[model samples]
Target: MSTIILVIGYAISCTKNDQVIIPDAGASSTTLVSVNTSTPPTIDGSIDALWNSATKISITPTVPDPGNGLFTGYIGEQYAGTLRSMYDAQNIYFLLEVTDASQSTNVTPWYFDPTANVAGKTGWAKEPSSKTYDVNGNLIRAAWGEDKFAMLWNIDNSTPKFAAQTCYASCHVFTPYLDYSGVLASPQTATTPPTVSNSGSGNHYTNGPNEKIDMWWGRLGYITKDASLNLMDDNYQDYAGGQAITNLTGGNANGRHVDGIVPDGTKSTIWPYRPNYTVSPTQGEVGNTQNLKLDGTGASVAVPLWVIPNAGSANFILVSDTTSGKAKKVTAVSSAGVLTLSDGSTINPTVGTDYQRTGDAVNGPTAKNSIPANIAVPLIGGRADITCAATYTGTGWIIEYKRALKTGDVLKQDIDFSSLQDQVFGVAFWNKSNNQHGIQPNLTLTFKK
Candidate 1:
């Protein structure tokens, strides 16, 4: 086993009646076993010297069963990675490095279309296609979203099934209505009873009430960055009465929710994380500055509420294909709904104003330059517990994360690692596709004492 040596020095304090003593620095040194360090590694994306002494566990992508719908028919190229972990007296740390080919940051950007007759032609563009089918003509793989990573851990061991099934413990697929050819039918509209026809394989929920799982979700580029730290969305999974057979909207059926306040203004209510937009338009007639602006002729016209005038190459990127792009930074947005960029240039708010030609998968011929729809902001409350630092190297990604072993979470939204017990956890990676992901389940984590 690898070991890390930590050098320590102490000075003796003495009163007038006591003697002062100085300890030799060489004799004061102590060696800490790998994975249990007296000094914690820095929470930066770069691999530090201390990491050399830690154990490296290989991480390979695994396909899920077709019935479960969690990457069932994925035919994409498989890539393997490595994982290393260490713990201090107060916090547990993780270092995950994955093998990826490209760096993808753009997520559903808005494109401008001038030829369209209707006003406000700017709309969200669909991602490029990269889907593959199997011999039976079943859709196997689809790519086009943002790069992401996630970890699911059994909280307090409340769900014993997680020890054996890992991520599969919470994945429950309801019965789907079939077609005439014995194939699964699409979800019908206005059905008498709610069904899982549109459930797309399954949803995540615990087996029983009060059971919980801690989910650490990290988006490679979409999440907020504080200094060098990229904050992961701290989330949890629990039972919510399973699929809603009565409600057609699938209300409260899926058990995955953020670790924050619920809808009834109650801290216990389960609510999805709302994006902190730079500017959200108020619902009203379009003439105001919020949603739509007034044209020179007093006609209601739609214009982008905010703009990053000269966002540098690193913060902002213009991509032609999925593999390559130019980079730029998204500095900040104007709260006052000002269209003037930092360079003193103002954008024309006319109905036919053209931004640029951004490539689109759906509207191929009229691809236009794309603008980001929203900016990344820090989440509040327990949802912000985990902080991460991630860097996308030319060939892969380096992600480092840290969180307290015991967070004083009154709602039990987090896993308690203070006991240093062997933890049952699973990991998944989404490489550009939102619905498809590669999972590594039934994994065990044993912290060094």
Candidate 2:
């Protein structure tokens, strides 16, 4: 039978029933107390009044050694942040503030290319790199990647090494030649791809079965506060065995998986305006007929699916403009097969140039701040348990979120805090790149008596 999970508002209470949730583990040394609150803070990005008196925890993340010769290539500035927690009878709320020089919103976004055809999408371009790498082949910064934060909670003490290793417990690095499990009879290289059956280089899998960790992932560029969905991808990690690769694509295998069924079944079909992203034909106003335009020679050529109308003040749309619904997107085409903007202006094709939003001027027609690569959609099912909001203040980011104290998920996808027992968890921050991140492990969480 399908379980019914209630969606509670910021003012409503979703307390734990009379059920007792007993964990199979013990406590740690350092503790971050979750103080009691008669008045809970709102989950908006703004700092609320009740947060002034709550206990806070310092979070300073640093790059971790993955143990192999493989390097994260991250040479970006390291910054520290603060974490605050509070709880009432029904829900637990969190406030996270971190320092960052730049607000990276875009990942890999599509652009209008006049002379290229990728995967049958003719005249389209996508940024491959930020070109900000150092001489040592280390990634100096993520000029094109988004800013992100994540937390992993130990589930029922299933992972014994969690308090000590934290994120490392679920992470395994593979060499270019050797496999951890010795499952493959032969060695593999960068050219030879590694599958679950074979191992070469990659990580993020649990050591054994039944070892589960609940993950709360927040992407600054992907934060959505709409009713259809919110930000924060509710994911989890379990055993996929040693030598298994991290699952970038959605699924239950390869360790990391979303909270609901396989393939992100609860993911929203529509996209929100906040955390603005490049629109596509399927999800936005662009249509299939607008894919191509007639050139001066009367030959059909490819065109962009979307563009910012009257892009005068800025080369690209800003996050603030999207939130206010001022970022105009024009998808209508002219009778002569030319692209038209909302202001009735036509986009003339320019060879050897592309309309792109990126950090690199060489790869962009008009360089500006980055645009979001993904749209914000609410996650349904078990994945929709958490509600969140985030804001970037030019210098850093402020994120606020909340979840029910107890969510009776039959799939064991969540940890129950009704018992108020101390639990161990690990938090991480990703400045730009994906693999390179700072992790603070073995953090003990306890409720104030």
Candidate 3:
């Protein structure tokens, strides 16, 4: 039976005894905190077990009717199979099994005749020898020669694997060799041939390198490429059309010269091919602002933190004298991109300078100046590190301040503050301490509203 996991959100109110207390208010109770209970899924299994339970598919080679001396050995027939599995964590595993029972006896090798001056032929082309099958006898090769094979996967499917009415090995369209081998009397005996290395050498596999192949291999659970190409790791010119062999020969044959080995004790020659890529998160970055409503239900009071642009602003504010107590009211005039006070005094809004807002009298006849709400009192050159005290409750922030009154009273102003780009103002009652008692007084502060 399959197990289905259900996740539920529950709020818990715990007392000093470590026991959960469910309030009578149900889920609407703000005194409780909700918690989610769910674990991420994963996959666990051995490589062999994974391979056996995966989906398996076969790829084979096709035989030409008018036997081209090209695929001669045992009629150039072979098949390969691949197995794929997906783990619980969505990780994908691929195991390729190749079978070439004919082995060396069924090998047919050919090279492109560079001097042949064929219009489009530029590299080595191999044509396998013909094969004759007896009614009740084993397959026999009418001729014998060296053989090489390469398998291609449609990892990206950018290009057609095989052209119509043509075996992939017939047209010599996809050459995995870097340097076309010139016609020679005998084939090279070295295990490593002089042909360009498809896996490296920066030649045949120009589009898909080993590094790209590995990345796609790991990300298979989350992504998939269109097509893949498998070429013989060795330098032999035996190319196969894979599972689409019939597509290449106009329905003449159903498969190509590919083999599938279950990858036992031997290392498989197949390599995944893919293009270079960069991974980016689908959700992107987080934003800095939240919505606020005026219905008294949204975040009303919030600490204002201004990010100053430069050091000049910082120095200007740092040198300002906050203890002066005396306030100044001056008119700010801007012209020709320059700012100056009405007193004919010019102040540079650079770092280390203190800016004061000026306006009409604030409270009584004794006050000659007051900070105006329309005036900007900016501390210039302050770095972007400006920070103010704020209370964050997941959804909002609150800013707090105190108010002073002439009645020798002090009170707190709890205004729903928004952004620093605008002015703010509020009123509250202040409490004063008398010689032997405390008194309350009406108080108000008028600055940048």
Candidate 4:
């Protein structure tokens, strides 16, 4: 809800007929209402007065002119279009008038369509009657209309400028009121200085005497100064000997340009320019996996699950834990449906022995010493002990054990081994404590060479 007020550069008329009007000089006759809340009371006169006063201060002459030729060139370049200043404020209404005689000859009143976009398209463009020239032949741009006007203050300068092409007017408006304290000022003058109300104490225009117009022009790679308002040489140069006039035309058109109204009422573009101030919300990386802490209740947080590369083939695998945390490898599955792991090893589960038996249970050779020379049991028996001992592990479980066979030995058992050959297999672990507890550990098994 805080307000920001920016002092955009002023448009000085070349001709006296183009003079800007100040509000009638008298104590406000109507009851002044606070603009802080929704559905603020109507006080048109006070709003207009405050707006005019703020505009006057923004246009007040700060530094001496840089001679007529340079000033004219600056205006000519600025006429092409240049962003002057940007600020935010509360309920105070602000207007920017661009008198383009070439574009409009009659009373060209500035009007703005404050409506936002719909379906990703601007509603203003659809409103046929949104733009019109006023009776004075000046291009008038107003911010809000009716109840929607309240949303105007909520707008940051960039959105309005970028979305609705508000930059076409070349003038920016700031509202509420800003304190000019600590801002450099011209010496006390015969003409009464403009009075500024300190309503929004912290709010001030981004560009001010402390931040000279020259500094902005330099940033924009172009220079600008008023030629008609020059003081003596003593007043023209700063103590550092740097001329007050700024050169914005850095001699490059590398940056995009926007249009602005010149003092001569001409439409011109300001090239390679940047705004005096900007505000941006915090943003996060696209593929960040860090846990995002949420603030306040009912707030939702989103994290990216996976990324699909634009090229190559797409396949789904269990999310990798190793490479995800450190150096992990996404097991590559070959076109033959073989799962290849980083280390070379082939896994093919046995059918009758490796798999669980469903039918009648096999009574063990009751005693290891009283075993028959050769034992015979149904292939589909409920369960058979493949190894003499219940459990023994080296690389994999010993399904059928032999005392003389060494590790890595390929020993074939004659009990229907064909049913298990070439069958793909996967390993799964269960937490013995809980039947429901199971986990797929970081294991990648590949077929042997």
TM-scores of the candidates are 0.66, 0.66, 0.19, 0.16
How does candidate 2 score on lDDT? 0.53
Order candidates by lDDT, high to low: 2, 1, 3, 4
Instruction: Tell me the tens digit of each residue's lDDT in model 4 across 50-87.
Output: 33222111111111121221122112111110011111
lDDT per residue, candidate 2, 269-322, as tens digits?
A: 321101111222222111212344333333444443345543431322333444
lDDT (Cα, tens digit) per residue for candidate 3, span 211-304: 0000000111001111111111101111122212212211111111111111133321322111112222221011111222212232222111
Residue 52 of model 1 has an lDDT of 88
Task: List where candidate 2 sits over 4 angstroms from the true fold.
Answer: 1-30, 67-72, 75-77, 112-123, 129-142, 176-200, 224-229, 241-253, 262-372
Clashes of each: 15, 3, 73, 37
Q: lDDT of model 2 at residue 116? A: 50
Prediction 3 TM-score vs. true: 0.19
Q: Which is superior by TM-score, 2 or 3? A: 2
**Cα RMSD for candidates in order:** 15.6, 11.6, 38.4, 38.5
Task: Score candidate 4 by lDDT.
Answer: 0.17
How many residue pairs clash in model 3?
Answer: 73
Q: How much lDDT does candidate 3 score?
A: 0.19
lDDT of each: 0.52, 0.53, 0.19, 0.17
- What's the C-alpha lDDT at position 364 in model 3? 11
**Considering lDDT, which of the candidate structures 2 and 3 is the better prediction for this target?**
2
Candidate 1 residues lying further than 4 Å off, grouped into runs, are: 1-34, 63-77, 114-144, 177-202, 223-229, 244-250, 262-304, 310-354, 358-369
